[model samples]
Target: MTVTQVALIKMPAGNEYFNLLTKAGIVFDYIALMWLLALTNGVLSPLFPIAYLVVMHATIYWRTKGAILSSISLTAGYSTIFAVQAQFDFNTTFVFILNLVFIWIIGVFGSLIVIRERKHLKQKEIFHELMFTDYLTGLYNHRHFQEQLRIMTRARQNFLLVMGDIDHFKQINDQFGHLIGDEILKNLGGIFRDLAEDYDAQAFRYGGEEFAFLLPSIEETRQISFFDDLYGRLSSEKFSKECLSVTMSFGIASSKSGILPDKLLGYADQLLYSAKANGKNQVKFESRYTYYYSKAKEEIAASKQ
Candidate 1:
């Protein structure tokens, strides 16, 4: 959530809230100076960003967009200053005057920090997004997909888990250049995402040419229809001139039972092998076969036809 949303949630809005926010804001200004007095334990050490208070204050002062809410958070964060201040008598205006002067100096530092923080925040957001995404396909990576599975299972939805493997993917890479193979993977990811995003289903890049789909709100017995629809979709989508319209072998398992994470995945893997063995471009469920290497060999032999 944005800082504004947080502020709105935590404090009442309007002039009354603004007053509390301003009080906190000023305390932030005061604390900045106090910390500089004994430079060691203060923000200047490892967390120099704290010393850059001028950036945050100035941004609020000029932007005025979330000024009130921002101040509320600033105040709440630095309110501990009251306890620290209680330790120092200072007993004079001298401390106050010095504090203001220190703030003025650091405002320059804050200005630099403000520009940099904006860029830093943008970078942080991108880094976090990349963590969820697969490099080969634009779909969510396996780690993120599994996380979603756990969340959905906890929510207790009737869901279909479809595991997909590209037919004869290694041969595609071997016959064509790896670069071309990669483009196919990337293209397929986009195709799957477009297909699933609207259905409240999620598509994921489980690794290499294997993708996963979680179709929520599926009825227990109608799970077969879900795979058939997906199979038809994949069979119909167009590809670039260099690439053929590829078919996927799918293993679909529906669970109202909601198995634990490891077991659920194991079941999906077994079903994936079943589909691969039964013949490429088919879907299966509840298949006990667990051998991937052998199933892959079967797929390779079948692909030559």
Candidate 2:
């Protein structure tokens, strides 16, 4: 207990015995936090020092920001306790001043720690940069697509999975050569990027001839309007080489209806294959994901009848 000569601060309890006990309890809490900070040899030993700092910091911080109450309390409480423990064998004044210097020094040290951690994180990210970026198209590869799909699924955000394959892409590659095919893919990648931006979606190159998308928080109306704009854009978009027109068939499935990523992917793939089977350049959204299209179809039929 720090039996300090506190002048004007009177105890709140009415009974004298309870006042002593209350003072003792406050001192015990102060002593516990102080003991953790007092050890000089191994300050963060057993990782208790950070815990003490957190407890005291929270107490003082809820009082006021930029107020040095925790630091002040820790220094004063621990120094007084240490002086008592040392039985005046220690120079308490010098020790208190030394602790103050270190507390200020640790503030600078904390800033350095933050800077170092950020730099290390950036370096780590550079090493982990995705290697499977499609140079011609600016989209992720098949591996990246699967990895990202798993990530989004685990995050449990309402998402839409779409499979897009260029209509007659191989024919374009064969007839115009790989250079023109590359240009076409880049042009289409630009369109996909634009589409993803407008809808807060992500695009991935699923394979040499296919692309994928994960569109987050897409409701039925936004979903239909999204694809409608996409289909319209690709149908009318002009490529740089000889004013060529690019078109793609997209198959989409949504997570709002509780479709898992793998099954949703399969659904979109099936729709894409069916589109190829039916003829190219059109979209098919299946798997209870027909909210917008179904409503549109109903409205149109009602209007006609």
Query: Using Cα atoms with residue i matched to residue i, what is each candidate's TM-score against the true structure?
Result: 0.55, 0.52
Off by over 4 Å in 1: 1-114, 154-157, 220-229, 286-305
Q: How accurate is candidate 2 locally (lDDT)?
A: 0.63
Q: lDDT tens digits, residues 146-246, model 2?
A: 88887777777677788888878788878788888777778878888888888878888787768888888655556667766776677677775643876
TM-score of 2: 0.52
Q: On a 0 to 100 scale, what is the lDDT of residue 177 in model 1?
A: 69
On lDDT, the leading prediction is: 1
RMSD of 2: 14.5
